[model samples]
Target: MTASYDAISPARQAISSARRVVVKIGSSALTSLERGIHSASLDSLADAVEARMRAGSDVVVVSSGAIGAGLAPLGLTRRPKDLATKQAAASVGQLALAHAWGTSFARYGRTVGQVLLSADDFARREHHRNAQRTLERLRSLGAVAVVNENDTVATEEIRFGDNDRLAALVAHLVGADALLLLSDVDGLYDGDPRKGDANLIPEVRSRADLEGVIAGTGGVLGTGGMASKLSAARLAADAGVPVLLAAASAADEALGSGRVGTAFAARPVRLSARKFWVRHAADARGSLRLDAGAVRAVARRSSLLAAGITSIHGRFYGGDVVSLVGPDDDVVARGVVEYDSTELTGMLGRSTHELPDDLRRPVVHADDLVVV
Candidate 1:
């Protein structure tokens, strides 16, 4: 069925049956000023999470606000522009964010565990697998995993653009059944919520319907606007995880009332975690320009053959990440190179059947490739 805000019953049903869920709370929802945490919001969130736990669902919270919480006490009015300052704020704010969750959850006799992630952690296979295992262990131990980006050490290039994307990836990594994206806005609006004509977009079954509903840069907290949330929704949905976008204040009601927010329906079949990482998270170090036939083959989910490669650029070692560029020179996917740059050049355009037995294998296996 075509998903739309008006027809969110399917997504609602998913939420109702979801056993494991990942909730992403934006910085605006978690803190009021740079100096202190939002106690009311924190308490309300803990209550919602506790209720979910009571229902026997495993809950993980991916939160943002370390920098926001750290800002005011440091005497800053707005988010700092410099990377060092931002990192400093995050270091301080992270403690406060965790403390708030711990203190609030404690009242309900729940334990909270802190998980800090960086972009690299999700990119590499080993680290990603380890993270998933650790989170699973934490849940089994009856502790709520409260995750946030490792902002203190993150440079500009390594930083997650926003927590929304990080949360979406986390959902995939942990095999979450649903993702809840909490923000200041109640739900997605057709126009800017500040504008009277803006109407709430209740469901989004297709990306085409989201053409003009991009969020404005008007939210009270956090740099990510509606566009980022939409990206997050799309990410989660594509991974076979449904998503709910709603107001943080309404979190409890949304989780309990069974009738609020914008729900993005998920695809029926889910991609494997490794493939998701290859398709959505891995950074490419070089580009492999391919012939038209190679493009078609890759599009059909075939392994990239060395014979189809026409050109290569940038230096990459064996196992280094690279992009598969189509005939039109657009990146179609990413994969790890089986051969180094120099070796690939010698093997390029040589059909696998004609190559020596030692070189006959596919350059990149389908299992290791991710289409963009």
Candidate 2:
């Protein structure tokens, strides 16, 4: 199940035969305290990516090093803990990072298209489509898309580790065949890699493999820990995209040979992008508490009717995303509701035949629903 360059397994074959791939470079892997942006590593990575593209893989790179790069320039030796300082550093570092990527890729006579995104880009339908088109356009023109988070304009919330999750979203957005996550560490370990007894996990075939694994925190220079990488890997893998988690230093070996990292095999049943969005992207405004029968119906991909619902939680308008919760209080599915919570308050536990004509419609349609 490991993605070795020389391996011939399904996961390895998928990586080797992938036509479109998303490569994510973490901040700790791309920058350092003493040198700021790691030029040698960046140059080498650009070379590896160029070689990969020439080998017929369309590459999209999601990079995180802006804050790390900005630290040295601002005379800061460590990553700033505060949001304002982090944003200020990113404002300065993004320019240097974009320039570095442009220069490195230029050596191969390839142009780099800088794309800075926020969470909204993937959550909103219009923004997602526009970003998708932009990335596709860049790839069509033989330009490498250097995608990063737009931390400069962020206010109220600042999550430095979100780039890892963004990379997963990008993979599904572009219908990528594989996702390569390059960070500071080479691969996942059963325990802390800093310990002598910890063992490298070569493959993750299912959730069972990660049952007791502790996902450590982010590194000194970057925010995404092994847990974040694992979470991102699962997102792509569950959606039928193969994933490889490796170190930036091993970019050549990992990209070219498909060796030197843990491989997450793509699920046999691929989740459609729309369903994937519903499962992972759609924000639930409200919830419907369903009976056991409704849970079974939802799991079977049936339309959620009012008769099976016990109660509604929260206030949301019609057509908003709502969570379908079972009697156990666990969300069983998520979908667009057909009626407002206020309107549905009276409709609970009533069959369509018992309700008035105007209020007899299904609460949520099957097509808009996805079982969790």
Error of 2 at 131 (Å): 0.6
Q: How many residue pairs clash in each candidate at the backbone level?
A: 6, 1
Measured against the true structure, the TM-scores of the candidates, in listed sequence, are 0.94, 0.94
Give candidate 2 regions above 4 Å deviation.
Answer: 1-7, 155-161
TM-score of predicted model 1? 0.94
lDDT of 1 by residue, 24-135 (tens): 9988888866446788888898899889779878999998888889988788888878889988988889998899899999998889999999998887778888899999
How high a TM-score does candidate 2 get?
0.94
Worst 10 residues of 1 by lDDT: 1-10
Query: Model 2, residue 108: displacement in angstroms?
Result: 1.2
The segments of candidate 1 whose C-alpha lies over 4 angstroms from its true place after superposition are 1-8, 217-220
- How many angstroms is residue 187 displaced in model 2 relative to the true structure, after the best TM-score fit? 1.1
Work out how many backbone clashes candidate 2 has. 1
